[model samples]
Target: MALAYFNGNIVDMDDPVIPIEERGHQFGDGVYEVIRFYQGKPFMMREHLERLYTSAKAIRLEIGKQQNELETLMLELAAKSGLENADLYMQATRGVAPRNHLFPKCPASISITVKPSRELPQDVRKQGVQVVLLPDERWQNCYIKSLNLLPNILAKQEAFEQGCFEAVLVRDGFIMEGSSTNMFIVKDGKVQTTPLSNYILAGITRLAVKRIAEELQVPFVEKPFTPEELLQADEVFLTSTTSEVLAVTSADGRQIGSGCPGPVTRKLYEHFQLKVK
Candidate 1:
């Protein structure tokens, strides 16, 4: 049975004690972080937790415990759940409130769950997946990993309806990123991605990719590129916590780079695997 950390206590998954008035439920006032674990050890845990702290501060939600305590609890929870490889998700909400938008006087509530890790479909990783472009319709503070995700959810649903795996959000014809992942493109043997900004999430995997690119000596540029540029690029990819690196083969039913994962993508994919090992 999976164990969860709730309000400083480890509890069974079936517990129903979370108050209905919890601010997270009533107003979506919370922040979260997803950390990947390998062999019972969380990969890049420090980085994830750092971002979690930043997110919480952005929303003025204070965690009751220190960073070290949270890290210890996370490892303990993973061990107690007997998870060797998984995703550890932790969230903090502004606590229960009286159904009002006003700030509550209570302390924040912390919840953590560890679930079995899921790998991306092998075919999609190898053959690449399709994506559709949508206008960026999200709030300006997207850099914070908050719980208000309705816009992102709707965009993802739209992508699914269009028979695509993801949506690349465009603002003023410039491709910002996918609804839930960082976007990258390769042109003329050079790699490019949007600079970290309020328009997109500064993904941990995206930073890792930059390191990999530098080590591999691949030319990289952190400049904005347009959707049309992506459509004509020799290779396109997306990065996230779950999806280390994925190629984009088609956009709006149009073929991309011979309609297959390009060589540069394969090289990066291989390097990504080695880094995770």
Candidate 2:
């Protein structure tokens, strides 16, 4: 049976006793983070937890457990789940409260779950994936990894309907990022991605990729690029906890650089694989 860490207790996956009036359920007053674990050890767990704390603070939610305590609970839960490779999902909510919009007076409730790891399909990794461009209708505070994600959900659904793997959100004709991933482009043999602003989520994998590019002496640019520029890029890719480094072959029916993963993309992908290993 899959074991889960719920409300400070390790129990069967089905035994999580979330209260009916949980603020996360009623008002989406919560934040979450997913950390990838390889060979039973989480990668960049400190960065993930730091981001989680930042998100919680942004929403005025306080975690009941300290950072070290949460990390211990996560590791213990992963061991109990019996997964050598997995994703640890941690969330903190404002706890159970009456059906009201005001902030709850109680401390937040923390929960964690371990799930089997998922990797990008081999074909996608080799040939690159396709994406559709959609308008960015999310709230202004996109930096916080909040639980309210209706706009993202709808955009991803639209991409799925069009036989695409992800959606590239366009705001004011500029490409922000994928619905759940950070977008990058290669032009003139230089790597480029959007700046860390309220327009996009500051992705941990994205930061790692930037570091890798710098170490390899590759030119990296963190500037805003439009969807038109993204289409014209010699190579387009995305970074996320699960997607890792995946090339994009097409966007909005336009072929990107012979409609295949370019040489630079392949090089970076190989380099990223070594890091994960």
Candidate 3:
């Protein structure tokens, strides 16, 4: 089953909820989150809410509900959907107002939907995926999970056109991250990724990887690595709420480290599966 929520009402997924003047739809003025539920339980729901609120605050928009309240609503909605494995997508917009460049004086528009979780093909995950490097043509505040995603969408489409699964975004000759995931490279048995900055998003799954690495006694370093370094590394991987831990076997038509999922990536993913249980 699938469901949609608008303001305070739970409705059918196909129901018309938001109006034409919604800021999120009009100007992409909002922030959103996707929480994965496994066995009817949410994975890191609190962390997701914290990031959502952080993004809302960064954009000077109020979500108009406490974290716990939002969490409860999400849980109830997911439960109603009855999907054991689900993805709850929620967003908060500035509200429906007259089309203008200034903020409106209306209550924030909160919309949410819960549907089946998406997963890649088993063979694709087993063999790993390919990515193409693209310029980071995005705003400097990439840290905020804002609704403005034209640049990202374009990069992803370009990667798809190039027969790639993802696009690794680069700025100033260094890898920032994937269009939607955090990028990492394994070198000499250590994990290296770009450090947290305004140019990079602090991914929740990336945080999970760090903690799992510490628990597994794997050396995880947060340092920016060049595309050349990534191409020459022992292995490359990416992490995100939806993608989880995925390997990158090639980039820019160049094979990376035997062009297979490496042992470290496999081990980390194995542990990540257990953590989500």
Candidate 4:
């Protein structure tokens, strides 16, 4: 069963608990995180929480609870849903206030929902997916996972209209990342991805892939690459919390690396499964 939580109450998923003046609803003033649980156990819970707090701080909004307290609430919500494999989405906002542009002096509003995991089809995972390259039009603070996602949503929708899974965002002739995933390419047997910066969100799954690469002794490099380079690479792939490690067999309708999920992506994905287990 799916569940919804607001402040300190577990409410019906469709109930309207947030006021019309809630900052998140009015101005997108919030930070959020989607945590995945397998068999009721969370993966990298600490890292996810840290990033959540970091995003809140970057936006000058307080979550109004200690990290451990939020973690406890999340775990309890996930367990209460009775879903062994679940996705817990949590958000912290600047709270309700009368129509105004300034920050309000009110306790932050926290909401959470837990539902069964949305797993991709096995065929799509095995055969890989296509992506469209779009210009990066997000704010300079892309590193902060804030609620202002208009640009990202637009790009993602554009990709979907084109029969693609994700929008690979490019900035200044270099690939930044996907609209919601980190981009990677394999060249000369080395894993290459964009280095951490304000231009891209540092993905936890990307970090996991780096660790898996090291464990397998595969060379991992962090640097920006152009679309031409991606097309010329030995392989292409992407990573995210939901997507995990997914190969990019086509970009902008161009086939990549024999138009299949490459060997390195398969190996890293196998190790990721092991890590989760």
Q: Can you give the TM-score per candidate against the true fold? A: 0.96, 0.97, 0.99, 0.99
For model 3, how does the per-residue alpha-carbon lDDT over 52-121 read when each residue is reduced to its tens digit? 9999999999888999999999999999899999999999999999999998899999999999999878
Each model's lDDT: 0.89, 0.89, 0.94, 0.93
Please identify model 1 stretches exceeding 4 Å from their true place: none
Checking candidate 3 for backbone clashes, the offending pairs are: none
TM-score of 3: 0.99
- Per residue, candidate 1 scores C-alpha lDDT tens digits across 140-169 of 999999999999999999999999999989
Top-lDDT structure, candidate number: 3
Clashes of each: 0, 0, 0, 0
Give the poorly placed runs of model 2, Cα more than 4 Å off: none
Q: Model 2, range 38-120, lDDT digits (tens) per residue? A: 88888888899899989988988889888888888888888888898898888899998887898879878887878899876
What candidate 3 gets wrong by more than 4 Å, as runs, is none
**Candidate 4, overall lDDT?**
0.93
Residue range 1-277, candidate 4, lDDT tens digits? 9999998999999998889999999999999998899899998889999999999999899888999999998998898999999888999999999979999999999999999988989999989999999999999989999989999999999999999999999999999999999999998889999999999998999899999999999999998899999998889999988988999999999999889898998999999999998
Which run of 10 residues does model 1 get worst, by summed lDDT?
1-10
